[model samples]
Target: MRAGSFGQLTQDKENTTQVTFHYVEGNTETFTIPIPASEFQEEVLQLLNQPWLTFHLVDQTVFICTARLIKVEIKPAIPELQGQGIFSNSMRVSTMQRAAAGRLPMNT
Candidate 1:
């Protein structure tokens, strides 16, 4: 999640694609599909070409009629840094070493 202005809610940039659809019936719905950052755009484009759009949520599958769609807003956000990289692991180890030696690691 990224910080914003005082009252703004932070959004998680986890590996997901946000697709907002505005139908002709004046209904708007947004969905977050679990997709990797590298393939977000291509996947979304493929999904949109079909007559029925399907999303697999946590407990259910949502189907949207693409025929009634009037507008769509697709945003492929920057995903958060996964802590599996070399720099992240090294930093974590360094911090743990400092704490073990009775020295407090400064927060970034």
Candidate 2:
């Protein structure tokens, strides 16, 4: 139920592995699997090595696409703030936030 950007991802030692998938069309899905804490890396590696990611849900299994490509079709990009000065960052942030908030001028 999120819009605009690929949503957040939070991981910690106390929880199982979780991954969120975002599509080119703006759809998203998340899958969480309770796995042995010691096998976290192994599990992730196994999944990433496969062609697609599998989700073993309660009722059924879901397969998500995982093809990798060098180029992606992206909409107008929000400039990433790097090591710029504070004022420059602030202005870019304002512009990006406004665009994300759907406040762009009609001509744009």
Candidate 3:
């Protein structure tokens, strides 16, 4: 599981209570996803054309991406009642390392 802030809230009626959060799975990579402002959903579907990419939301705004199915945990969000305005949130991501299987390397 990971933790972060829901950066900003959108004005759209359907998105008013949603916030976007930025997260990184490993050391230097980053992933971002938008979710409901106050609730955490079990599953999240992300639109990606690539077949090797997958996305998962840990909390309302924090998300993670991986190519394999792994265990994930979610943490509680720290409500910021003082700042009800819209803003962007940043988060940190954690991932488990796995051994690579024998496969032909792809050529660029």
Give the winner by lDDT.
1
TM-score against native, each model: 0.53, 0.43, 0.20
The local distance difference test score of each candidate is 0.68, 0.51, 0.35
Candidate 2, residue 63: the lDDT equals 82
Pull out the clashing pairs in model 2. Answer: none
Query: Which 10 residues in a row give candidate 2 its minimum summed lDDT?
Result: 69-78
* 1-108: candidate 1 lDDT, tens digit per residue: 455543342234445667899999999999876664567754555666889987877899998988899988756643433434313322235766867777656578
Question: Which candidate should be chosen as best, given TM-score against the real structure?
Answer: 1
Which has the higher TM-score value, candidate number 2 or candidate number 3?
A: 2
lDDT of 2 by residue, 1-108 (tens): 466333323333234544566676667666665653445544443555678766778899988766642222212122332243413323235767877778655674
Global lDDT of model 2: 0.51
Question: Candidate 3 overall Cα lDDT vs. reference?
Answer: 0.35
Order the candidate numbers by lDDT, best to worst.
1, 2, 3
| TM-score of model 2 vs. true structure | 0.43
